[model samples]
Target chain A: MNELVHGALYGTLIATAILSTIAMGIWFERKFAGRMQQRLGPTIVGPAGLLQPFADIIKLLQKEDIVPRDADRGLFDLAPILAVVCSLGVAAVIPFSPSIIASDLDVGVLWVLGIGGLMVIPTFAAGWGSNNKFALLGAMRAIAQSVSYGVPLVLAVLVPVVLSGSLSISGIVAWQAQHHWFAVWPIVPGLPAFVIFFLAMLAESNRIPFDIPEAESELVAGITTEYTGAKFTLFYMAEYVHTLVGSALGAALFFGGWDGPFAPGLHWMVLKTLTLFVLIYWVRWSLLRFRADQLMRLCWTWLTPIGVALLLVSAAWVTFGGTN
Target chain B: MQSAWLSAFAFLLVSTLVGAGLLGAASVLRVRAKYDSPLKHNTYECGEEPAGMSWMQFHARYYVVALFFVLFDVEAAFFFPWATVLREEGTSAFIAAVTFAAVLMLGWLYAVRKEALEWQ
Candidate 1:
């Protein structure tokens, strides 16, 4: 019962935090985009539109749920749930502070990465279950794009794992606390796994510039075209949750999660993750989407080699210097 | 070499079993339903029926690309441990690692020159 309560608390708190972050992210993006484009963004929704995401949530929830005729009803319902669950579950292993983590598995890094792959299952299911051609195509694009990026993303992540000599995320942060930051400390015969990791993360999260799966202009909301109301809202929530998880993972691995001088542990963690989130959005707005072929090429041709090199160099350095 | 290979094998076996088990459980317990309609069955091009089969026979390019990926992926896996030990190995390890990478790169460069990486 205690374990179950812990699990429930874990799920609820993380889900709520993710939803809030995503809400804020949307608000920030809109405001920032408007500023860039010389217009006001949602200023009417209660003081710089701080309450706009809530309004949007209410609106989305109030909308009618529509299931397409001849669609696989079961899977259609299951897809969004799966997406949300997987995305939210990623928070379980993420150490928000030195003291606060949902669970600190020995193989926390792999657990996060592996469960993240499960998020793809729902995406594929959503496309297939919807009985819509666009959704199917969108799903297919997701599969191709994710697989291409994911290979390098995991490879890139291994650089830190090698450096820290541990797959546990907390251990990685502890390693960072002991050593200089990767941004400063070059991993022996230097390789840019961090850059590759960032770019691959952008792709994995299906953010702008790599959001080919949901090319709204080209595919009409892509795989999610047919979803409506709460289901659609869940998908939106899942996307943001995925983004938060990705950003958190990036913070944990590269930026040294919850490691800072001035703030308390959770505060430091929140600050690091938020900074990464902002940076991702900044990059998103600054860049244009890549062509599907180009995205795949970038992953396979450039990132993979860099990731491989980074891992190799880090390993060699560790072997010589002294094992972690 | 033997220890490394054995460890990797063990890791692969354990992860695969766990992954397969979870995937199996998800599949077995999940309820599913079938759907069939002209609109639903057709390929989706913005709600318009698909022009052709999404799975047409491609040229030899995709195959070649897959081949290259397989080769490089395995080689990249070996690079991790080598990286941890690079400085210690000093000149000898560097030389051996360089040679190893160079041989793989040669194949990669050859494939790239042959336009094997090109898709579509």
Candidate 2:
């Protein structure tokens, strides 16, 4: 009973934190994009648009919720909820600080990947449920892109697992704190693996150079074509939240998660995560979406092989180099 | 350990409820346009009238990609245990992982030769 109460407390706390962070993250990304493109963003919403996300939420809440006449109502309603749930499910295992994590599962790495993999289903559901051609195309593209990149993504994740000799996220961080950060150590394999992991991360989250699934020029909002009002907001939030989780995982695996020198708590983790998030945003604003064929070719021919080779190199480093 | 999973489950449940509750509240609070037009809710295809159904068969290329994904995904699952034991088991484990990867690489080679990855 005591454990249950504690669990509920932590559960609510973490959910609230994630929700607020996502809200602020949207505002920051907008401002960042504006500055990058030489325009002022959300300046009139509140002081420098500090309250802009909330304003947008309020506005979305007040809009009419539209359901298409021919759409599969059940699946259409269920898809956004599933997307949000699966994305938030990953937050359960991520260790923000030693004591701050909700649950430190033994197979944390695999758990994260597993939950992340489930995201494609809801995306497909939304696309198919809408009964729209563009939505169907977008969904197919999303599934193909996410599933293909998921291979290299998991493979890149294994590099750290090999280096740390543990599958637990906390254990991985402890290993890096004791030894050197995997991203910097063994510079040969580590650097390449980090690059691969980061690229795969971008692809997994559907950020540009990899945003072919939702290419506005062609697909008219893609899988979200038939969604409106709060449902659309849910889908939008799910995408950003997934990005947040991806950035957090990247920071944890490669960037010495929560292991800074000056102050030792959650601030370091937040700083590392936000830095990666900003880097992703910068890339999003800077690059053009890849052609679908080019995206698949790059994933299969280049990224996967490179990821496999890097994994082997890390394994050899552990065997011969005697680090860790 | 059990409590940890319970807590994780509890978190998932609470988050889902909160999300659903929020959406439900929006549904109640939001304004409804009760006047329905047959033309308003048609499948949006860039402001054009509806054509044929959208559920037509797609290209076989997606299936090929999915197959490749499944192949690599299983290989990744096999690699995880090897990764965990690599430092302790050392050279023997490394050899096993290499052989495992080599076999998978053969499949990838076959796929390339067959041009399964080519986008038509």
Candidate 3:
């Protein structure tokens, strides 16, 4: 009974944290991007626009909901719900700190992958249901990207699992805590595997440079082309939420979750997660989106093959006893 | 395990409520002229009148991509269990794993040779 209550409390706390962080993430990204582009961002909302996300949400909620007459109404409505749900699902397994996990599943790493894979479904549904050429086109691009990039993402994540011989995320972190972190412990595989993971993570989450699925200058908002008002807000919220969770998951897996100098705690996990979150936006504002062909080529020919090779190298490292 | 997932279930249920409730609230709270407008409901077509159904046949390429994804994704599942026991199973496990992946690599090679991954 106590365990159940602990899980529920932490689960709710984590959910609230994710939603609020997304609010600040919106403000932070805008401010960060604005500074990079030589302008002030959201200065009017509330003291440097700290409350901008709330303001945006309020404005969107008051706007008239519009579902196009041509759209498949049922699927259109279903997509946004699925989007937010899938993004929030991974939270259940993430160990923010040693004691801050919701479900410490034995196969926690696989849970992340399983939940992450469902993100593609919502994108496809939105595109098809919108009944717009651009929407469908965007969906197709997204599906292709998901398929290609998913391989490398899985293999890269697998590197840590292989070395530690544990599928549970908490297990991996325990292993890393003993060895510092997979990010540096076995640098031969850890460092390269982290690279592949980051690249694949960007693509999987539809972050910039890999955001062709929603490219405004080209696909005219892509899969989000037909959405408006509150539905659009939900989709936007979902994306940010996924990125934040992705940051947290990556930090836990490779950066020593809750393991840092000056004592171990949730603050360290938050710090590393925030650092990666900022890095995502930095990369977004700094680089141009990749050509679709270039993105595919990078994934299949480069990242995937290298990801598998690194997995082998990690195995060799473990087998030959060269690990820390 | 039961208790842990129970919390996860509670979390998911609450999130669903949050998602659905927000959507419901927005529809009720949103502004309208208390009138129906046809123009407001038309699909976006780059400022032009919308045409036929947008859901149509797409490239056969997406199918091939799905094929490849399934091949590797399933192979990936095998690795998790194999990894956890690699320490106990030793080099025999290593060789078996590599050979399994290498055989799958042949299909990957064929896909590349066929240019199945081309985005166009």
Candidate 4:
């Protein structure tokens, strides 16, 4: 009974934190983008636009909803909901602190990757259900992009698992705490793997440079072409949540999550994650989007081979050099 | 540990409900302006009349890429368990894993030679 209550409490708390952060993240991204573009963003909403996301939410809620006459109503409605669910579901395994994880699954890394992979499904559903050519094109591009990058992403993740000799996120963090961050240690493999993982993370989350699915200039908002009002907001929320969660996962795997000097615990994790988040934003604003062929070639030709080689090298390091 | 998964599932359920509830509320709260026009219902095709159905056959590249991805994905799945035990398994295990990766790489190479990855 005690365990059940504690579990429920933590579950709710984490959900609240994620939801709130997502709201704020939207504001932060907008404000950050505004600064980059040399303009004020959302100044009218609340105190330097801190309340902008909330206002946007309210406005979205009040906007008239629309569904295309030819759309598959059932799947169209379910896709955004499923996207949000899958995006939020990944938070369950993430450990903010040593004692603060919602679920300490032995295969936490695998679990995250699996849940991350599920995002593609809803994206496809949205595209296919809309019955729009652009949406279908976007969905097809998204699947190809995600699946190609996913190979390297999974392989890169394996580098840490091989080094730590455990699939658990916390265990990997503990290993890094005991030894050194896989990102910095074993320079030959760790750095490359981390780079591949970071790039794959960006691609997987459909951020700029890899956001071919939603290339506004081309696809007319891609998979979301048919959605309106609150439904569109749901898809928007799902994308941001996925980006944030992917950043957190990246922090946990390669950046020695929640382990830092001067201070320790969840603060470090939050700082690391936010720092990565900021970096993602910076990258988003800075880089040009990759063409579909260029994106695929980068993944299959360069990142995949590097990822596979890094995995083998890490395995060899574990077999010979030996770490805790 | 088992309880943790339950907690995770519970969180998923709660979050889904919250999301659905929010959408439901939005539907009720939002103004309903029913402008009935065939033009409003047409798919946006850059101000031009949308020719034919959007569900026509697409390029075969997507299917080809998917096949390649599945092959690599299975190889990745096999590597996870091999990774977990690599530290203890030592050199022999390294050889086996390398062989597995090498064979997969050969397949990738073949795909490359065959232009399966070519975007054109």
- Screening candidate 4 with a backbone cut-off below 3 angstroms (N, C-alpha, C), the clashing residue pairs are none
Better of 1 and 3 by DockQ: 3
Q: Quote model 3's iRMS.
A: 1.7
Over 4 Å off, model 1: A1-4, A187-191, A322-324, B1-114
Estimate, for each residue in A1-324, the C-alpha lDDT of model 4 and write its tens digit. 554565567777887887799899889888899999999777887789799889989899898777777788998899999988888788878888998887777888878888888888899999999888899899988898988888899999999998998988999998888889988888878888988998998998899999999999999999999888889988998888888988898889998888888886799999999999999999999999999988988888888888888988888888888545
The residue-by-residue lDDT of candidate 3 on B5-103, one tens digit each, is: 676666676567668988998988789769889997888989998777676887787888787888889999999899999988889999998898889
Residue A4, candidate 2: alpha-carbon lDDT = 60
Greater-TM-score candidate between 1 and 3: 3
Docking class of 2: medium
Residue pairs in clash, model 3:
none
Index of the highest-lDDT prediction: 3
Off by over 4 Å in 2: A1-7
Judged by whole-model lDDT over C-alpha atoms, candidate 3 comes out at 0.87
Off by over 4 Å in 3: A1-6, A322-324, B1-3
Cα error, residue A237 of model 2, in Å, equals 0.2
For B1-102, candidate 4 gives per-residue lDDT tens digits of: 566667666667766875697799898889887776777767778888878888978688888888877888788778888888887788999999999999
Error of 3 at A241 (Å): 0.8
Please write out the lDDT profile of model 1 over residues A1-324, one tens digit for every residue. Answer: 444455455545655577777888999988988887789888888988899988887676655455776468898878877777677666767888886666666667766777776777989899888777678778877876776677677777777876776767888887787875665566442337777877887887788899999988787887788886667777887787778788888888887888888778788788888888888878877888878888777776777666666666765666565544
Candidate 3 reference-contact recovery: 0.72
CAPRI docking class of candidate 1:
incorrect
